[model samples]
Target: MTLRIHFTGEDLARTHIAPQPDVLWETMLSLYRLRRREQTLVFGEWKKTALGRVPGSVRMLTTLVPVRGYTVDFLTPRAEPGSVAGGMEALRRTTGERLRGDMAELLARHPGKRLPGWAERLAAGCPDALDALVGAVDGYFHACLSPYWPHVRAQVDRERARRARLLSAGGWEAVFSTLHPSARWSFPVLELSYPADHDIHLGGRGLLLQPSFFCRQTPITLRDPHLPPILVYPIEHDLDWARGQAPDRRTTLTGLLGATRTRVLETLAEGDCTTTELARRLGVPPSTASRQATTLREAGLVNSHRLGQAVLHTITDLGVAVLGGRWSGLIA
Candidate 1:
């Protein structure tokens, strides 16, 4: 049986909460750096494991150059060599390279979903400036992945339909926002279908936004060799107290460890506390604390860096607003 689903572009646009272009740009760049850095840490940790070091040939092939063309490095050895171990290593390398490449391409092109008019205006102001900005923006796009993931899937499908059309499409950030009102970059609100039977996510009716990005075939098993299997974060009443320290609509934070993480943020709003201290207060292990902290830090919900030997976590202005639901106004 076939059933027709209807949803307008206006619907999808509304789900997005609009932040100023400059603010969005900065957030993207920061996210890019964090993702890159986090991946590197993960790679290093993996390398120390028995299965960590993939063969040198596989390693070379898997190494991807940022912003380079679509060619992945390590396909040859895996295809030709008759070594299963080598191929497995090659596949691991390939996974990282492919994920990074896709993410880079996504970032470089995604913002157009919200800022095509701004791009056009910039191009009109000074042609050379547009060229320079594209290069600068390309580097910055990586961080904004979480914010613009919805556009990444749609844009990719459009490109696959034809080759020349894809190359000449400028970038995702240049065209995705085409449906928006040119006068203001605000997006139309959108709805998402959370299907019970299958993994189909229909946003704005049939509009599919990055299905693969959300597809997780494997179980989430925490197996950190360096730390315990689980760590806990403290819970509090007001996470917003920390967020109140930042500007409105300046940052966006979204992640998976919601229940425990949200509670920790709410508790912190009362005042600052260390991970161990917070864990004691919340009744969770130290490992859970570490992972959630890392996730929160990457999402821009919390700020953390080395303070001597200890890492201090604090909610930023964006975090405060998110906990308080102050960002509802920015959504279409």
Candidate 2:
């Protein structure tokens, strides 16, 4: 089965990449992966840990996300650059009407199925059901992903930067060609090998290319074609990438850079932030924060961009590498 996306001139013009991972989407996909036990090499440990941490009540939430089948669309909100908490907040706010409609659609797609009790409650717009579902998701994330989020974000950022560079050098052609092995670009049509066969005509709505850390092999698209078009593809990573070892050399880096600068780098790895925000987060003087950022920027470990009156500092690829204790160059 293949998904062929027909693109127009406007579609080509509007097609763009997302700057960060969609937390809700990732969480939903991770649950699917854990249920399917797919990519055991990468997710085995995480799956074990997540399942162990999942409460008895929350275990029912897994039934909603089958190994292969329709999962509700509202489970994942639109992609935005930020923490998973923001995504959870969106999930919590899903309107009862929309939830019921999506749940109805899910059940309708799979005929002769008995709806899980929790799902039934959720579809009925029960507040308790919503809270329970959200709690389960949060518990799963804390158990499985929070510990490794820094490493995950680093890899995602590096991939985004690489693709951005590709876009700059050769436009969309280079990007599409290098996107993934499963995605084939032929003229105005982009063919994606999917579980279901369908054609999505991007009637000038374009598409959003989102790289996912948990998505493996096959890329996923939004089931509702009428909604915004999005393609969630797996980001490439080595075996050790999932293992997430920062090396023993971090102690040396900490000693050299002092605790405050090291904390700044660690915090920046989560996401970009202004110097003032960084200072407030770390409880340091704004001048001290500025000096540290300047030092890190001069070292080529961090990059700062002026966004209006505030300058946002983000960890560069080298910076991520250094945080992993892989960089052996001079600390000064």
Candidate 3:
């Protein structure tokens, strides 16, 4: 089975690469990976730790995300590029009409497949059902994803940087040509090997390319094409990424700039990011991160710019030089 995506010249020009992973999508797919025994080799430690700690409230999520086939579209809304809380809020506010329609389609497609009571209540727009579902998603993230998110995020940032370099050096054709082995770019069409045979005519809506640490083997797309077209493909990882943690290699830099400031600089070096994202990555208070970033900007080691609601920070050439040859060799 193959998914043939028809692209226009406008589509090519409009295509976007997400700066970070979608929290809801990543949590939903990670659950799918957890349920499968075949993923043991890839997520061994995570599975071992997460299985025993699965909260009773979130256990019902197992019913919603099956090991195979479709999951409800409302669970992973792509309204905007925002935090996990924003995504969950969107899920909670899924219109009754939309929820029921999606559920009806799911039932019709699967014939006699059994759905949990929560699914029925959710379809009917019960408030408690929505709360319970949101709780489950939150609890699941706390149990399985939060502990290792920094490491996962770092790997994702690395992949994004690599792709950005590709885009700069060789244009869209080069980027698409090496996107993934399963994805083939041949002129006006981009072909993806998938579990179902389908075609999407991106009538100038363009496509969003997202890299994921959990997505493996095949790229995934939303069932409905009318929604913004997004392709979530796996990012390559090494043994360190698989270990679910990043080593503390900033000791030398920490000596130069206090620990917190060094961390701020290191995080900025990964890629351009918002103050909020920097704080989250460093596990520091947002105000503290902002202060540190301001200090760096004043010293001419970082540059800050505003894009909509976000204040993005990027390392300056002097900042890279300050990181010196040793740190450069380590990340390289």
* Predicted structure with the largest TM-score when compared to the true one: 3
lDDT (Cα, 0-100) at 22 in candidate 2 = 76
Task: List, residue by residue over 1-332, the lDDT tens digit for candidate 3.
Answer: 99888899999888988887778888988987788876665688778788887899865676667678877777788745537778788888888887787788778777787878888998798889889989999888988898878767766776677678657655776567667777787879888889899788899989988888889888888888887788888875543444533344444767768878887887877776788989899998889989999999998777775544667676754565567554433443
All candidates: CA RMSD in angstroms?
22.2, 11.2, 11.9
Q: What TM-scores do the predictions have?
A: 0.23, 0.71, 0.73
For residues 1-332, what per-residue lDDT tens digits would candidate 1 score against the true structure? Answer: 11122235643443221111122222222222232434332222322331322222222122222222222222212121223333333433334333344434434544442323433333234444334433333333332332343333332222232112211342222223222122112233221222111122234432322111111121111111111111111111122221222233323332534578876775555544467756877888967776777777787777553333445455543456566444322211
Positional deviation of residue 41's Cα in model 1 after best superposition, in angstroms:
30
Kindly provide the TM-score of model 2 when superposed on the true structure, using C-alpha atoms: 0.71
Runs off by more than 4 Å, candidate 3 = 79-82, 242-332
Best by lDDT: 3
